[model samples]
Target: MSKEWFPLIDEDKCIGCLACYNKCEHGVYDVENGRPVVVYREGCIDGCHGCGNLCPEGAIIYSGEYKEHIKCSCGCSD
Candidate 1:
């Protein structure tokens, strides 16, 4: 579990596919109203973005000091 690492889901981009929920091995997500929610944020691993990588809509993003470890597809990187 990590204090800084967690998933942020973009509701607009999310299609309620539950891909992130299904990809996560940890109890980090919960299905609510046919969508996924970050229920156990602290359960996220320090350098893991497995769920985000599996999202077809690219709805998931990670917030933490480990941002540099991931390649930003949206060109947000500087």
Candidate 2:
């Protein structure tokens, strides 16, 4: 399997602070489950520049290729 380039957010760790959205100007982040989720995925493989780093609880992650680094509630990281 090949790796798909994209960044993702951990919704569970997200406190609905919209930090990724507010932090990025690419509109790559959006509100999901009251937290910020990766909406626009394009040329965002390396991650949202600093979206994951801004996360307080380290919910955001850059998983392996072909996998989604963004995670949702229930401790699931795609």
Candidate 3:
């Protein structure tokens, strides 16, 4: 987990969907009033965007510099 890596949810864009909450396996998110919050930011994995990818409303945006070395869902690391 990286301290600089975490998901930032845009409340205006969020529809209170639990997509991010259910997608995160690192205990990085928590539900409050039906919306997902980044309660455990330090728990977020470095270069991991699983939660953001699963968000339908594109409400989740990750911090830190984008890493191109990480592998994609298609198994391509570019």
Candidate 4:
């Protein structure tokens, strides 16, 4: 199974720059009404935050890394 991960866009922070849409090579985002939207959540690769890291407005939020806790087998946090 693929790891649970997706990008969340902050509408207020997004400037419609299309930076995130242009940076994503996995077809994870789409431009709708001049705004970015996650059209293919499953297309996003696990542990990949390229879109979020490339957002010029810092509007993209990646939840992949945090979700790793659910599958972690190492008892490092205890």
Candidate 5:
């Protein structure tokens, strides 16, 4: 399966608490320079919000929800 979800850490907002790094059971995060980094993007599980929800500073952002459709600008109908 493709890497559909991963964590995005905001350096400025991160308090270096390591809450996210510890919360992630998939080894998706690591500590470097007192900040959490996405070391293993492929290990992230799709649609899981465990790390983001555990982050105290709200520094972790999870992306990769699949969208079913896109609006066409050319006025085409599927």
Candidate 6:
């Protein structure tokens, strides 16, 4: 099956601009530790491609579930 894009944020790089938070329609990004964090990542778009591009600090990434989600529990069919 085809994988999907997830949200991610780099704490060190994030400038806490909230630009990404304001732009995202999915409500996936949030503020934490003075940085934008991908909180509701799994509920984010399965094909979401809008958040990462707008980040001025380039803190966002589309990888798995929250970009850091490296483990596989995708509930897919065999």
Top TM-score prediction, candidate number:
1
* Weakest ten-residue segment in model 3 by summed lDDT: 69-78
Write the residue-wise lDDT of candidate 2 on 2-73 in tens digits.
435556666566677776677765666777667777777663543233667666777767655543345332
1 or 5, greater by TM-score: 1
Worst 10 residues of 4 by lDDT: 69-78
Query: Which lDDT tens digits does candidate 1 get at residues 8-65?
Result: 9999999999988887777899999999999998777666768877799999988876
Give per-model CA RMSD.
6.3, 8.9, 3.5, 7.4, 10.6, 9.1
- What do the candidate models score in CA lDDT, each in turn? 0.79, 0.59, 0.75, 0.74, 0.73, 0.64
- Candidate 2, pairs of clashing residues: 4-66, 6-45, 8-70, 9-70, 9-71, 68-78
Which should have the higher lDDT, number 1 or number 3?
Answer: 1
lDDT of 4 by residue, 26-76 (tens): 788899999889989887766566777777889988765544433222222
Kindly report which residue stretches of model 6 are placed more than 4 angstroms away from their true locations once superposed: 1-4, 65-78
TM-scores for all candidates? 0.79, 0.60, 0.78, 0.74, 0.75, 0.63
Worst window of 10 by summed lDDT in candidate 5: 69-78
* TM-score between model 1 and native: 0.79
Q: For residues 3-72, what per-residue lDDT tens digits would candidate 5 score against the true structure?
A: 7667798888989889877877778888898778899998776656677777788888877784433333
| lDDT for predicted candidate 3 compared with the true structure | 0.75
- lDDT of candidate 6 over 1-78, digit per residue (tens): 343566667777878888778777666777776667777765565645556666787887667543333332222111
Clashes of 2: 6
Order of candidates by lDDT, top first?
1, 3, 4, 5, 6, 2
